[model samples]
Target: MNMSEWLVRTARRVPDAPALLSGENVAASYSEFAANAARIGGLLRTRHKVEPGDRVAIFMKNSTAYLELLYGVWFAGAVAVPINAKLHPREAAFIVEDSGSKVLFVSGAEELHSLLASTCTVHDIEAEPTFAAEGAAIAAPEPRAPDDLAWLFYTSGTTGKPKGVMLTNANLHAMTYAYFVDVDDVLAEDAAVYAAPLSHGAGLYNFMHVLRGSRHVVPLSGGFDAVELSALVPRLGNVTMFAAPTMISRWLTTARETGYSGEGLRTIVYGGGPMYQADIEAAVAHFGPRFVQIYGQGECPMTITSLSRSDIIDRAHPRWRERLASVGPAQSCVSVRVVDADGAEQPPSEIGEIVVSGAPVMKGYWNNPDATAQSIKDGWLWTGDIGTLDEDGYLTLRDRSKDVIISGGTNIYPREVEEALLMHPAVSEVSVIGRPNAQWGEEVVAVIVASTDRPPNPEELDAHCRSLIAGFKRPRAYFFETALPKNNYGKVLKTELRKNVSGL
Candidate 1:
């Protein structure tokens, strides 16, 4: 069945139930949402001439209208391409052009409309009329095939230009099923608060509220605001939410200052980057055992590995606690393996690149056969992330293959070095990158953010690293900065770091 049918089913089953609530405004119920989606779908078809499989870009912040547009595009038998609102016009236009989106939706942002108007048809979402009067005129399209493209997500291209990953209706349905299996306890009564950008996979997957007929709440300002989140916990009682590691760090600080207990919160799913054990422990303590750790990518839509509440609760044993550091066991629908460069599977405890085979994996990169060929081989999506699987079947992510630092033929994972630096009392955040060296080929370099009023010297930090990790893995150079640059999802932009420190 087509994934868009979920909205129709939910609307028919629970027409009066709350479908979407954006801040103080409520979209009423599933029937209302479906009607609005149909109306918008009709408008796109009749006025905008949105054809089947045509790419319609949503370049707006998180809102009730954004969700409507997503379903509307799919209902109209077109593909929805949600671009990052934080991206500059040039970057947004690149995505629009790359996806070949014929029409773009813009809400509350005039600059974005101005940017896309030059390349494609631009529509202001606020100006659109409600479906209440357009019922008789609006016509629903024919059923969509499971293999029809539902969405196009752009991944950060190692080369200069980003590539769009084409996800089919079947891919999304598979992802929703796998996600529900991983977190079966989340039900219709639960509400999910979206703290991440709606453009990213984490945000889009988390917003799959149709499966369980749950309520979706987007922040008022359409950005992560700690103060607003603290208030939202009480307003939307017993809600589940997801955030990036950096957002969690900020929330931890805010929760401490405001004495926010997150008492009504059922689950706090975190992914996009590795959260430090200390941070996870702190979050678990404050929010109870509802901290679920998920590890996946845009290609997979977040169903690879999951660490549930039980895993975090069983942290008494040092070994068990160490398992919390892992990304956890593979989910129900996915088959994960660690393979060498030659695509040979590695034995237990041996580090190699992590590869996954699953229904949720994207069909391929849109219009890029070379990249599609490089990523998907023999039906397995090569993640490019290096990891190891224990005899117990738990998978531990070591580092990304490109991020690995090879110094004098010894492979050094930056996560190991960064973890040691995080243990330092003076260190608040840290990132490790490899630098070119004349003798060792590539030398390790550590960049750190010291605690307020406590600056750490390079020799002292280097000594700490040496004490914790092997000498060869220790960073030879150290740079102290007030803050480290990170992407929208809280992942440290290592590419930016490499460019910044290439001279060093």
Candidate 2:
């Protein structure tokens, strides 16, 4: 059955059950959510003329309307493209244009509307009613074929342009099924709080919590608020939440300061990047051993390698704890291997590229055959992440092959900024690396070796970058040195650069 129909079934099963709660407003009852979705779907077709298979982009922060729009798009047999609201106007425009999205929905954000207006038809959600007049029950749009594209998720490209990862209906279903295997008991009575951006895989996958008949709650400001989370955690009983390492760190700090306790937290899943040992320990101490760690990519949504609560409690030895440093074992229906350049699997403890083969892997990159060929070879996805599989089959990530910088759960490619920086006449060499930040899991730091005797200040360099790239990609810190470290082959050793910046 099509995933959209699942909601209709759910509404029938539990009509009065709360499906979504956005701050003070609670969209209580699945019937309410289904009717709202159907109305929005009717509006898109009758008022906006949105056609089946057409791309509809949602450029908004996390909210109830955002969730409804996703279902509305699916109900209309259109593909939903959720863009990062934190992205710059140009960056946002690039995605809208790249996907050839026919209609853009903005959350009353003038900046987003103006940006997308140049490319596609823009619809403002705040100006429009949540639903239109009740129309005849439009037969749920035809069930999408397994291979039909459901979502177009853009990931950082090594070549300086973002590549849209085309996820099929089957891909999402496989992920949902895999998630259920890991957490078997997620039910309609539970509630999930969403703070992560729905644009990323982590945030979007958490929506499965809602699909299971749980209520979804968003923060008041539509972004991460530690102070707000501390209060909200108790308010929403038996709620599960997903957070990045940085977010968990902040919540832990806030909890300690105010003697906060997770009275209602059942599961706290953390992903997007590594959680430091200290942070993990602190989290376990405060929240008890109720944390779950997931590791995967957008291409293979939720093909999780999870560190369960049991594993966290049994911190056996320093070596065993080091295994905790790894991304954990593959989920059911997934096979993982560490392979060398020749695609030959490496033995345990040897670092190589992590390759995965499974039903959860994406069909291909949208409209990009060359990229698809490069990433997927013979049904296996070359993750482009350097990692090692342990004797027990757990995978430990070393580094990303592409210059993709993940900072605060957002992916940023260095080439995108480097190309922009090259425009400056005074710049000679530039390398952007993710430096450990207490708040942001990683913060962008650019190391530049200037050609001109008078070096540009960090603000000047930042301003130049800001003009070309998204705000998130702009460097948070700058360092000027004589030259970048390179090997005999003249290849810049990013390892050395990272070490220097890390002060190792």
- Candidate RMSDs in Å, in order, are 11.0, 2.1
lDDT for residue 300 in candidate 2, whole number 0-100: 90
Q: Model 2, range 248-289, lDDT digits (tens) per residue?
A: 898889889988877778888888876888888878888897
TM per candidate = 0.79, 0.95
State how far residue 439 of model 1 sits from its true place (Å).
Answer: 35
Reference-based TM-score, model 2 = 0.95
Candidate 1 lDDT over residue span 1-504, tens digit each: 545577888888988888788864576588888888787788778777878889999888788777877888877889999887765555677788878898888765565565554458877656753532453324554477888898899766455366798888888888777777785466787777877777875456643577678888787877678889888867777688777766777787888999997866888777776566777888778767877888888788777888777887785766886688888899888899999999999999999999999888899999999999999999999998999999877899887665766554334568767877889999998888988764445789988888868688888887876655556667888887888999899988888888888797
> Candidate 2: global Cα-lDDT?
0.80
Point out the worst 10-residue segment of candidate 2 by lDDT.
129-138
lDDT, candidate 1, residue 214?
84
Off by over 4 Å in 2: 112-119, 129-137, 316-319
Each model's lDDT: 0.77, 0.80
Clashes in each model (backbone N, CA, C under 3 Å)?
0, 0
Clashing pairs in 2: none
